[model samples]
Target: MRSDRRTQLLRRGRNVECASLVYNIIEVAVSLTAGFATGSSALISWGVDSIVEGNSAAFMVWRLHGEAAGISEREVLKRKKTALGVLSAAFSIAVVFILYEAISKFISGETASLSWWGIGILLVSLVVNPLLAWGKYRYGKLTDSPTLKYDAIDTIICEYQTIVVLVGIAFVQWKGWWWADPVAALLIVPYVAWEAFHAGRDAYQVDLDASVSG
Candidate 1:
């Protein structure tokens, strides 16, 4: 019975990760295309972040599958630390890109132009992210997988950022506040930094645990 339950949990975790992979692929392609077409650096950076998050999801699938294949939990935990390290670096890159763009736009007094396609893409993401996050959260709890829970939180943050971007674009279109776009994009930087710090901290803690265990 215990073995059966473990198998079931692993299966669910795989399904969730696979779904996330597919979603992120679509998100990256669509968002980047839209960002370029609309000249929205915020959107471009968000798409890049999607690629990073997708890498983490891929690692989750690998880790969960390895455990199901009888690999030691400690080994899996070490790989997770590596994955989180990569994710932290990705977040740092994303922050740098976003800040650069935001500053450039602010200094140049250039407003980011939006398009119907971009707005449509953002709307789709607004819907998809919450649902994806909920699914990951539920499965993470069921399987007691902190990695999945962390990914779900990341997805939630992405969803919130989507809303921020959408609102920024909307305000710019409706009120002619060219600065709204950069201001909104800047608002997300603190959250991005917070996540990056936590990712690094989590990786560090995992490393300490592994060292002590060794």
Candidate 2:
């Protein structure tokens, strides 16, 4: 690829990451507030996931910025590995937190109240996250950036979680199924764990490749 085009793609990736960071920050505040008020385990897990997403976006911003500044391939790989490691750890933590919250709610026979605010935020995310993921995926492919691709996957996961949480909320509100909220939160765990495993494995592989080449 041409140097100018590469630079442009990197710049665009950085911008996408920045946008994701900003969105996740707002999402965290609103989701957490609504989750707590309504006692929705699924919503609370969504808020926690937003925190992880925000951190991932911050890491991508740094990694993309370094690459755009003409960093060496080895240095870039190192940054990617470090960012992946952090993301892997963050995802694992989110899984644990979600499991704990969901299980406790299940055991306690707790039910969440309906929150129009939570529903509105999730509806907005259903629209916004897909656009962000598309931009990230497109730029990541153009630039051959594994970090951005993984971030895109994370964004897509958030979209899936949004759908699950919304469905759970609907069941609770309409069908009087109090178990739906925690069950919905639990449903997100396997996918998240799968990504966490891949991120950690990729990070290790990157480190090994760097060692062999160095």
Candidate 3:
């Protein structure tokens, strides 16, 4: 009975990870397409942000699959740490580029054309991301998986990014406050950077723990 319950939980985790992968891939394509069409740098940056989240989701999928395959805990931990470290580096670099683009837009006083596609995409994500994040969080707690917990946090980050992007676009469309777009884009940087720092820090701590144990 105990073994059966464990198997059931593992199956559910795999399903959740698979769903995350599919959703993120679609999100990246939609966000990039709409962003380019509308000439919205904030939207473009948001699309790039999704790529980072997608990579994290991919790692989670890999880890979950490894667990299902009866891989050793040590091996899985090593892979997880490596994946988180790489993602942390990617997040830092991405944040730099996002900030640069936002600043350029601000300085140039550039205005993006209104895009219903961008708005529509964000609306869909606003619904999807929160639900997905909550599911991951609940499962993570049930299983005591730090990786899933942090993965859910990454999804939460995506939700926040979606909100800021929508607000930026809305302000321009509603009141012609052109600065709102870039300003809103800039707001996303701090949260993303903080998340990256924590991920990196956690990965390092795990490595240290493993080293001491070994």
TM-scores for every candidate against the unseen true structure: 0.90, 0.93, 0.91
| Residue-level lDDT tens digits of model 3 in 34-125 | 87787687898888888888888787778777766666667767777787798888789879978988898888998889877778888999
Residue range 139-208, candidate 1, lDDT tens digits = 7888777777888998899888888888888888899898887777787788778878888888887853
Go through the candidates in order and give each one's C-alpha lDDT. 0.79, 0.89, 0.80
Model 2 TM-score on a 0 to 1 scale: 0.93
Q: Candidate 3: global Cα-lDDT?
A: 0.80
lDDT of 1: 0.79
User: TM-score ranking from best to worst?
Assistant: 2, 3, 1
Q: Sort the candidates on lDDT, descending order.
A: 2, 3, 1
Q: What would the TM-score be for candidate 3 when compared with the true structure?
A: 0.91
Given candidate 3, what's the lDDT at residue 62? 81
In candidate 1, how many Å is residue 75 off?
1.5
List candidate 3 stretches off by more than 4 Å. Answer: 1-4, 208-214
Off by over 4 Å in 2: 208-214
